[model samples]
Target: MSKSYDAARDVFAGWEVDTEAALTALSQIPISMHCWQGDDVVGFEKKTGSSGGGIQATGNHPGRARTPEELRADLEFAYSKIPGKHRLNLHAFYMDTDESPDRDEIEYRHFIPWVDWAKEQGLGLDFNPTFFAHAKADDNLTLSHPDAGIRDFWIEHGKRSREIAARMGEALGSAAVNNIWVPDGYKDIPVDRMAARQRLEASLDTMCAEKHDKAHMLDAVESKLFGIGVEACTVGSHEFYLGYAIKRGTLLCLDMGHFHPTENIADKLSSVALSVDELLLHVSRPMRWDSDHVILQDDSILQMAQELVFTGLLDRTHIGLDFFDATISRTAAWVIGSRNMQKALLRALLLPQDRLKEVEENLDWTTRLMLTEEARDLPFAAVWEEFCERNEVPAGLGLIDDLDAYQASVAGRG
Candidate 1:
């Protein structure tokens, strides 16, 4: 260990927390870095006017990835800065294809390049079916569309996406999480909410009927409160997905930005874990709206990580990032958000869980509160610096200078 790290480790040792043990636990948890961050969610598909599904990436930062090669290069640079191995989260529209196959007809051959590249990097892949930014989705509907042909088109897309995810898992020797999130809703109050939900239920049943190996592909359904256009009636609300996940035995994806602003998503982990076998967390920071801001080591983030550790749900939760800020260097955004998550996890792992539990069980609320507050001031940074050194990544604000050098050398704007 470096001299500074050794000194910090000794400080943490005084608190009765093993800094090395915390580093080991934090390294084992994988945070799926989103591919969209590199390209501003503008995929390789040729047929796109703009996102009609309330998804808009703000700012036009220079050096945004324009092609598959550039995006992969940016991702590689990002992975090198973040400590430990992590998975890549991809959307269906990002397929490396020149034929420009429509969503319904997209084949696995289009993503072979992605799988090969991931294998070389020792990363697994998670996938999502793109249900927006298409001509068929112009009505703000997809799987629950009133038109039969439009619904069938998206259903077919879902089916093909599952097959691709399964193949990805088999190739990488890891279970690929395939998530379904659609922008199907109305701008005004609908006459019949049940009708729309029933159609969606039927569509999901048909799409999930052909089961892949559980060891290869894990299925998840996502929900949202509202979005840009469809702010009145979201078809796939939290209640809808929660019931469906319990009944169908699928993972329920709880996006941090997809709920009421006042709600704490961290509190929902254990309640949902009781019924659902697994969870897929779309970790993002929301401002007043569903603006995908870069994550920070804020209180909400720390609470979420602590709950994961305190409840022993780390093994059952699939943690993935879903933030896109086009105002800054895309590579730096990746490194910052990813490292913040790791820091939060380290903070969680360093908590004195046994001591806190003892106080809480004995109804010693004062001591419990005091101990928790004191744990926050522990030498987490020291442990984190040592972690970066061990993983061969730059520590702390050191990444800022490295990112600037990269932009000046290789990622300059035209």
Candidate 2:
């Protein structure tokens, strides 16, 4: 919690920014550092310890310091540059194509080891996600189809994941594993919804029965879609699915970016408020095209008010910042992350919950509230200014100085 969010939270709660816990909670936001790859995260790192450096020459050299020893030091330095307890998200897609007999075998073999490694680094890694392959291939389960092979493939993944988690639990003496993410659903029809439902239902049942050999729960189904290949997944559809999942013992993983164009902000927020179990999630920039997952505190923050409003109403869901930014180097990514979610933290703590329900129930009030912000209107550089101005640059914040310090930075250099 920094100064800006600290003030925002108290005001939202009808209290002044005075209490220590409230201030600490408000000021500290969860930033998901791009721990996917140490060097090539979005192709930002160049050689070791080097960065994109904005304009490629001058600017905040957007690179981390050298070695694992230097990572935290860099992170600490990054904190002086940013702020808060970051809920960093990392990925272990694969080490190399040559690391195993083949892609699938290797992914399964390396899964738990990578998770253990993340824990050692005090981080969490999203499991090998589905709905990405778009299986037009040998029984690939990435796409939607009226095919049994695809569902079978998915079952394999679930089964292997369960088994691996079991082994890891025994070997590690105990551990916590999570299955997280949403996928691009069926594209070309024949997606027997009931079958897909049955498969996942059975799979979840088995996993729960076995306990996955460790403490486990799903974050969210992570509903998203591309309009052309697949019509955008309507927020209402996701809302229905998420509620169903909560009943199944798995929780929702709300990606605020996944809402449809027609989705009411309050409806989306209300969905979260309605869920009962832990609603784990990954936060990133709001996308106009797809899951670009830019930084949340940047242009996409227009979606914040409703998002925070919902989180404020509940205590079950746990939030994490998950980002994907291609424009900057990994270090800059980390700094941007820190600066972005810190505000979300404070904002959540300060939510006008009592008014939230009132606003949610009365769509007009919520609309008026969202429309009041410049970000909600222009949704670009224009509102980013409002974001900074409203958040009020705290002492030693990196992102705040972007304009003046970055004028000659990433400008015109792309």
Best by lDDT: 1
User: Model 1: per-residue lDDT, tens digit, 81-185?
Assistant: 999999999999999988879999998999999999999999999999999889899888889998999899999999999999999999999999999999989
What is the overall TM-score of model 1 with all chains considered together? Answer: 0.97
Q: Per-residue lDDT tens digits of candidate 2, residues 1-414?
A: 445544444443342222345444444434445453223332211111222211011123344333333344344344445543333343323332224222223244555544455456444433433223222322222323346565455445555545554444444443323443424344466435566545555544543454453344233445543333335232224645565566765656566555654444334555555655565555555455334354565433434533654446434544555454434554456566655555444444433345545656787675547634422222122222334444454334445464335423323332
Q: In model 1, which regions exceed 4 Å deviation?
A: 49-51, 410-414
| Deviation from native of the Cα of residue 295 in model 2, angstroms | 3.1
Question: How many steric overlaps are in each model, in order?
Answer: 0, 10
Q: Lowest lDDT 10-mer window, candidate 1?
A: 405-414
User: How does model 2 fare in lDDT?
Assistant: 0.43
lDDT of each: 0.90, 0.43
